[model samples]
Target: MDSMLKADTADVPARENAAERLAALAYDDMRRVDALILERLDSHVALIPELARYLIEAGGKRVRPMITVAAANMLGHTDMAPIRLAAAVEFIHTATLLHDDVVDESGMRRGKVAANLVWGNASSVLVGDFLFARSFSLMVEAGSMKALGVLSAAASTIAEGEVRQLSAVKDIGVSVDTYMQIIDAKTAALFAAAAQVSGIVAGRPSDEEAALETYGRELGLAFQLVDDALDYGGAAAQLGKSTGDDFREGKVTLPVALSLKQAGPDEAAFWRRVIAETDQKDGDFERALDYMHEHGALNATVEQARDHAARARAALSGFPDNAWRRALGDLADFVVERAY
Candidate 1:
């Protein structure tokens, strides 16, 4: 832990909109990627395109795809391959969001009505599948077996992670190891693949590929950790969902998991009733937040995210201090700072 720097939340030093800064840094490349995304989002089946477009155009940071482009630019690749791959990454991401909203029973996505609610679960799921297929088509267009293989493997890993999370929900006995595995697969896998595939498209060496993947993986872990911390408070609007969704759903995030480790019998019993039994009532969320703050669970989660953010920054050390690398590092900082 000493290897990673820690700052008071107020001293975290991120600008008001680090994401906007990142977008500005990569403005040209992102515009190309966005253009490609709009073009590839089309479908002959009217509903398919419409539903996918609704989510695609919905205002998310496009963080993961931007990572794809940034990695390519860091390696000095000027081809259109990264653009195609970035669009594919976005499609894969959008597909997962659609599927995840249904799985999480989330009412909103990107602050808009969730696709599942708008189009029905069946429609959302089938459209997710269509986008997934479309993502593969775009991956094929990228023309790298290595890139295709990594992204395809990430797709499977994401599903496995999602299933693992389902099993972990309400199970207070779940270890931190299991919890870490869940996030690594569910959230970090695609991030790693998105960056690693950039190396493939750029014909970089294995070491650079591994480093970029580490950057993405650690960044993903940090991103999800901050999100977990946010669920206990009023930042749900920033996260594009209602507050207390994780608590109401009985999801076992790191904050909850850590708080469980320190619980007295009474606290443990309360946890079992609410999480294990899903028998939550009024004041339960407040009680859960109390436990989290009492145990320093939220702050501890932020520290862990900061550690990953440090690792993400370190992973980019092999690259020069160019705008792309600097922006990538700043993005890592932004992810952890979001917890504040």
Candidate 2:
């Protein structure tokens, strides 16, 4: 379990310039806010700090936290509360990543060894729990019960989504509906909570809050969709894991699910045998990839991701034109275009 966000080749260009964009969203002192996050994340337990630092220092794009800060700035709040909220969102996200890596048995993240790989699963899981609890305490400090409610619900949804994915493993019949449900819970719920909480903290009207929630939900869907696509299309070094790792794990992503349905008899038969069999050989990945390409599922999946990205950008129309809002729009475009 690594708390780090995987940086795709598609994300690098946007990230390289993220500092400049972030600077445009002014606060009283953004650096002080960052320092607050670092200080608050500290723990008395030595091991907690060690494992947590591995994740914090692993260097994520910190995009979710950025969204929280940006949304608050757009709504005219530049207080410490927004910074605390942003840090809470990052903690929640990082905790989920730690748990996910343990569940997924991910070996590498961000071009480095995964926490689970370096520290072992037992320590990683416990450290993840500590971070999750720390996030809740930080949320309480924000003094908005509405924000707490939204975030707590999101955490529950994320867990459920992970469990749903576990149940769907090796099940070739996992429909798009099931996949959508998983992504909505596992990915979009957190994003929605992050944006919605930002609005709540800023005392935004309900309608505006709803709009931000929608924006986050759609953006998250687009982000995860592109992530699924990259699992098939990216290089091992670039992806920070082996290509076709999803298929190798018998995890049915969007591309494979669509491919299984559209495949002709021979291809479909291959999918059936490979998916149903618990003991998948090394060759299964190669064959599954070939099937995905032949059936045009890979391209179709990328198109679906792009469609979501477009929808995400469109959702920002509710916000007034500002540098932060415009940057948000550009970030949406960055999410999809980076897949190239």
Candidate 3:
């Protein structure tokens, strides 16, 4: 354990509160985004507003919007474009969450009752569609075809990613590259777009835009890797759901894939029965944890996340040292650190 902690922190710089750092950097603009969200969330249909508000106001970290704002600030943007785009980014993310909760059949989100659980799956999905429409409309209102195209492409990619993931679930033979591809599309695509479009709106050069996109993609990948580890390593309260959710759902994340690769024949059969067949017995989660630890899969997953976090920081190398850059680097560190 001591050696694992040392290795995890090897290239990772210390950052006590990376999210708060990024939030403070973009606090004022985030407020504007918040106002715009409330304004745009309004609808004559009572259920639309109610369900949208419930999910939007839910205590998510709002990392995607913050990434949008931070990338804009990093590129010397001072206009309201970032603020407006930030709202659109938030809507895209919230829409995904609403839909995801229903699809995952999740009972909880951000430590509260899932919208689907409270309102029903039908309402949750429709509200998610409504938010998607609102997000696109917002991009149109922003009047940047380039930004609109970036986000629009991201939306489609995210859907495709989701579809790809649906196929991979319960298929224990999924490779690490396939797992990374799934996360890149489903999660990192938005992060990349949210950051890249800010550069576009700020009129940053193409290289800089690409750099921001890389930064966001690596950060998103690192974030998801950490989340995968946390499912087995973290307590239920920390996850806002039961631990081993990926295992129970028959989802094949990195830890599962890695452990499966290293499993003996007896262990492999156990995984096939539980994951491929979805026949979980009592203490299966505990045994899964034991396998993850025994094979060093969880620690390996965290180490890989730290590597992506480092890549995220390296992507910011061309940018000047400033609050935005610093906070973004810290945020990368915090993503990997969260696994601990």
Q: Residue 30 error for model 3, in Å?
A: 0.7
Query: Model 3: what TM-score?
Result: 0.93
Candidate 1 lDDT, tens digit per residue, 1-340? 2111332233544433556567776789999998888788787889987898889888688999999998898889979899899999999999999999889888888878999999999999999998899899998998998899999999999999999999888898887788999999999999999889998899988999999999999999999888888887522223333568888888888888999999999999999999999899999888888888788888888899999999999999998788889889978987877676
Tell me the lDDT of model 2 at 44: 79
Q: What TM-score fits each model? A: 0.92, 0.89, 0.93
**Model 3 pairs whose backbones collide:** none
Candidate 3 structure quality by residue, lDDT tens digits, 78-196: 78888888899999999999999988998788778999999999999999999999998899887899999999999999999999999999999999999999999999999999989
- Regions of candidate 2 where Cα sits further than 4 Å from its true position: 1-33, 234-242, 278-283
Error of 1 at 245 (Å): 0.2
Residue 122, model 2: Cα distance from true site in angstroms: 1.9
What TM-score would you give candidate 2 relative to the actual structure? 0.89
lDDT of 2 at 161: 93
Off by over 4 Å in 1: 1-16, 234-241
lDDT for model 1: 0.86
Candidate whose lDDT is highest: 3
Model 2, residue 234: displacement in angstroms? 5.6
